[model samples]
Target: MRVWILSDLHVDASPWEPPPGERVDLAIVAGDVADGLTRRAIPWLAQHVRPRARHVVYVPGNHDFWGTRLPDELARGRDAAIAADITLLNAGQSRIVEGVRIVGATLWTDYSIGRPKWSQAWGMREAGDRLTGMRDHRRIQTRDRLGSPAPFRPFAALALHVEHRDRIERILSEPHGGPTVVVTHHAPHPRSLPAGEATGPGDAAYASDLSAIMEGEHGPDFWIHGHVHASRDYRVVRTRIIANPRGHDTSHQRRDGSWADERENPSFTPSLVLEI
Candidate 1:
């Protein structure tokens, strides 16, 4: 099966637009399927993207649940989608499809622990307070609105990180006779991050386990990830890794200003597609 993989679409519901190619049998979205997974928008995704593919699988990233609870249908419809042959994975599980075993997990990074003490000491408390709107009601905004001094918690954050990695391990233990594909919002490989702050899911902790899984005699043939928005390729263990960012924003274009103009717009690209 020829499968196409992409992630971090971060779609907003207005007019459902199809990708610039023929529809295929499956679309695997790692995360950020829509701006929000609320009661309203989640259904819109089901209507717009799900029906177009024979099998649609997804995992919720930090963005999907950013400051919100899981939508009511996110679970039920997820199961329904699986029943409809559409698989929706959250901070869990593995799904087998057409000889390819797809495993995935949402975004759970160390940053969400709480703001770093150092950042708080280094003028971050006041900034976080102001940004969080404690001083002004209207000032509170989504975490995505800012890009510095991210929340941090060394211990609990570490625990959450271990949990997700353990999930990946547990799934890999099962038997699926074919090429395996692992989908994760936070890239498990070291080369995936930008210089920002060594944040995001601490891949360091899971490096050994990840290496063992991917390097196993029957490991995955390919691995796809989303979080770090860099379009690059690498090899981890015996698996080929592909990291595709959602897109580059031209509004802030001078820092590097090198992305292709045609590919600069914000749009949804189905995470994974398979052709029979």
Candidate 2:
């Protein structure tokens, strides 16, 4: 079971062409497949990888939620997943693929994760206005079709925690029958970040609880995530953490396809050719 893991494919810059001749059993896209409006990017990625891999699994990232309500975001994302003929794992969805129980979620960030320093990111903005750029403070809320008034902060650091707390808790508690795989858009654990990555305030917060879980006796056979654009693969207390990202245009991984020749940069896909 060789798997290709990619994350943060910020469309305009990132391009991925899997290595030819490699037998890919599964293709796992951690998150950030679109840039707010190009929702189709999700299904495009799925459709592209389907011919090569037996199964495709995906999770959603923050950018995927821009300008959309919680309900519509999930609905559209799930629909794209289905149309792409791929499995969509939102906050607490699980599926059995290739003999592994795959569990996935957005898991989100809570300001207290590691007491991150957001001193440089604070700001006061008007409601319903555009929240541009890539900062938590830049998240703006929009009206949902369900008429549920959205929170003032669209990307509030702890929003997902409050909304999907119970769902994630249940997922974390489920028993694994055999080799299991856990996937999330945010960093699963602090250590999951490579030496140079996972430095953002948001990353610090998102990695804490999940990182704590990786330290426990019961963890997944494989743990995967994106968010922190840098590509990193390491083994923690119990599981192997893989963060394979496509990153931006300047990213070394983007200069040349990582599939066939990763010699230019080993941080890209096929980070591991696990034959599980």
Candidate 3:
């Protein structure tokens, strides 16, 4: 099948549309079409994207959960997707399409991809603090049983990550008769980062080295992901890992109302397509 792959559209900042008359057998949106408040991402997909593909799969990125409690935002997205006849994957869900087993999850990082030697406890404390300072923690909220909304903190994010990772591992272990594709919002391996980029502890917030999973006997044939603005295509063991993110625009305005250099991702291809 001809599959179109892309992510990190960030439509709230910059809009996108497929080339005129472009179509594919399947379209996989890795995630982060927009923040929760605008609620434009999925709807935009429905109105402008779905008709171009025979099937479309959407995975919610961290930004999709911002501006509301997690469950509420997810519910809204799910409902919209269903109405549009789209498949929305979250919380480690899987679906079979034309003999292709597609597994998807947000796969939040465990904050150790860049610092593998650090103890889990130390990583959680220090790395967790760093991640908590990000906009995800500031904008996305989680609710208590009593319906009180609070920041979706690092601990909670890590717990959800563990759950999703475990599910992926379990699903991949089972036998399947068809090619498997794994989709995640966060980079599944550290190599997903741009080559030549400096590494630091903060890198843990963006990616996790899940090479163990990809190298397993029953691991997926292809893994597509987003979150890191840099686009990449490489192989780990037998799995082909690919990312095509539009990211933010190349330049931004300075105090003088002139554009300054801001190279977010120059390699993004709007027409990226892979045959599987």
Candidate 4:
């Protein structure tokens, strides 16, 4: 099967379209289609990208849930996806397409990928406070026991990460008849970080060291992910991991008096097709 992969479109910030004449048997939008869950991104994909592929699988990135409430937002996203005939994966859902077993989830990290010393000394709440600058903490909202609105802090995010990780592990361990593919919004291994980038506590917010799962006996044959803006294609143990993100648009002039041209992600090949 020929698969077309892309992510981090952030269409709300800038417009995007698939390369002309690019079509595939399956298309994977790893995540971060837009900032609003039920807004521009999903609708744009349905209208513009869905018809180009025979099958489409979408994973919701952190930005997709921005300006929305948790759990409820996920439900609404799922509903919208179903209405558009697109497959949306969340909470460790698996689907078998054309003899390929594909399992997907957001795979939120537990803030331990970089193993920062401060994180070990401080609690998750303190760590979360330190990361208040991240939009995930400030923009995404959830309800407390009394139904009061609260920021989706690191503690809750960690709990969710554990849940998704455990579920993914269980699914990956199960026997499958054909090639297995794992799709996630967050990168699964630290190696997915951009080349030459140093690891730090903040890095944990984007990726987790899930190499154990990839090295396991029943590890997947391929893993597709998007979160890190840099494009990557490499092998860990027996699995080949891939990420293709357009990142934020930088077409505007920068303070440095230089023009940034991220409008067309030079590293991204919209027509690049992977055969599995």
Candidate 5:
């Protein structure tokens, strides 16, 4: 019943070894496992991937899209000599593990396309290009003029909304009565300003759906995400919102060759241990 949540850890730094004998039932990697090309597999990755825990679940973040084939490729370990111990969750289908119905999607809110395009898997630039074109020109202008940066995006709003709801529906549609765990690479609900440790500008749709799911009788026990690059704990209705940003490399550089962690320092690493 204990789950460790981690997300947004850019692979520039290796994951630290968990303390010996410290038991974790499940590890939920929200996403952003690496920035682009995760060259050296963290010694811990292959080690802890299929830990003693009953299940280890992974979701893709926007950054992990860098050095890859289809977004789902990371889940499947398409590359030779590369193997991930955890179960990679991508769009489509409900996955059942350890008596839990787990459903996930790597889909982020696509602002430009005005819909959740599956193409975001083609790295950031290519996916961004596709999304940019999906935008509704008129709505873009209207939102721009009003200075209202929509969280779910206006043009793709209808499609994104449907996509979000469908994901929940898919999870609920599962025949098993076991409790479910929803994992995503983006924030699932709204938080106050100073939105500490959350995903970027398109998680509103997921957030909205999360609330609805939690309100229902068949709601998940917990919802975990990792896109924000920091660690935050909150709640969506009765669902506990756990976000862990795994990206640690800081883009901000100093003349003295020093950097800061993700939130402020250059060496912040996101690693959470969950027990399911």
Candidate 6:
């Protein structure tokens, strides 16, 4: 299978569509499909990006579900996936293609990243009101709108990661003789975060726990993730860890001044493609 990987393509940058004449067997989008849960925009973007692949598999990023109820958000995602002919993975969902097994979930976190710190703090509360993308992203309930004016549970940010270990454990437990690919929106290996807070899922603690739990085996043949907005390829246990993210705007950026410019770079472009 000619699998291509990319993630953190925020749809609010502008409505994006797959150009004609592109081709691929599978396209893996780790997360952040939208700037916020635009609801309608998910289907629009999914349908546009779906045809480029024989199969499309995706998970929503933190940015995709900032202030929404998890269940309602997931239901909307399923609808959009159906419209786009894409597979939106939840816990225990598995798809086998050409003998390669693919399974994933929206694994929730428990602040188990290195040193365990809260994603939100006192400053963060007021910060959103000042900054456009940085803090507003946390409070955004949907595209063109903000989430509740009242504060949310601080743990909510890390809560989604809670169930991930179990789902991933199950996926790793499967005895597929052929190649197995694990996809996650959070960084699977800490090293994938080239530079950042160096504390959460993008750091060493989570990866260490992940590697230890799936004992007796080093790891899967292939693993891909996106969260910290870095392009990395290395080994953790026996797995080939790949983190290739076409991220949204932030303080740091690789190329291009805006998401529009980033979108113009085709999926097959060297910056976006991760063939396997």
lDDT of 5 at 269: 36
Q: Give a tens-digit lDDT track for model 5, residues 1-276.
A: 666666665554544444445456676676666543234332334465456455666666555544433323343442421355456665534567767777776555433221243223322233224345322222222123344543223334335335755776676766676777787776655551125322443333233334566677666777777655555667766677766554554455678888743443233333445555
**Order of candidate numbers by lDDT, starting with the best:** 3, 4, 2, 6, 1, 5
lDDT of 4: 0.83
Better of 4 and 5 by TM-score: 4
Error of 1 at 256 (Å): 23
Q: In terms of TM-score, which candidate is strongest? A: 4
Compute each candidate's TM-score over C-alphas. Answer: 0.65, 0.76, 0.90, 0.91, 0.62, 0.72
Residue pairs that clash (backbone atoms under 3 angstroms), model 2: 19-259
- Per-residue lDDT over 1-276 for candidate 3, one digit per residue giving the tens place of the 0 to 100 score: 989898998878766666765689999999998886227778888877799899999998998877778977888778888989889988789999889999999988887765555544554565546445567877788876688876687777888899999999889888999999999999988788765231766666788889899887877999999999988998989999999998987577999998887657889888898999
Q: Please report the TM-score between candidate 6 and the true structure.
A: 0.72
Badly placed stretches (over 4 Å) of model 5 are 13-23, 36-44, 51-54, 69-83, 110-165, 192-210, 249-276
lDDT of 4 at 265: 56
- The RMSD of every model to the true structure, in order and in angstroms, is 8.2, 5.4, 2.9, 2.8, 9.6, 6.5
* lDDT (Cα, tens digit) per residue for candidate 2, span 1-276: 677777777664455555565547888888777655235556567656677768888877766666555556677777767777888787767888767877787766554434444422331122113544234334435444467765535245355655554565466577766677888887766665555444545344445446556666656778888887677678777778888776665434434656333332346654345556
Candidate 6 at residue 255, lDDT? 68
TM-score of 3: 0.90
Total backbone collisions, model 3: 0
Per candidate, the number of residue pairs that clash is 7, 1, 0, 0, 32, 8
State the lDDT of candidate 1 residue by residue for 114-203, as single tens digits. 234223122223222434412211221222224332333233324455687778777777777787777877666555555323342332
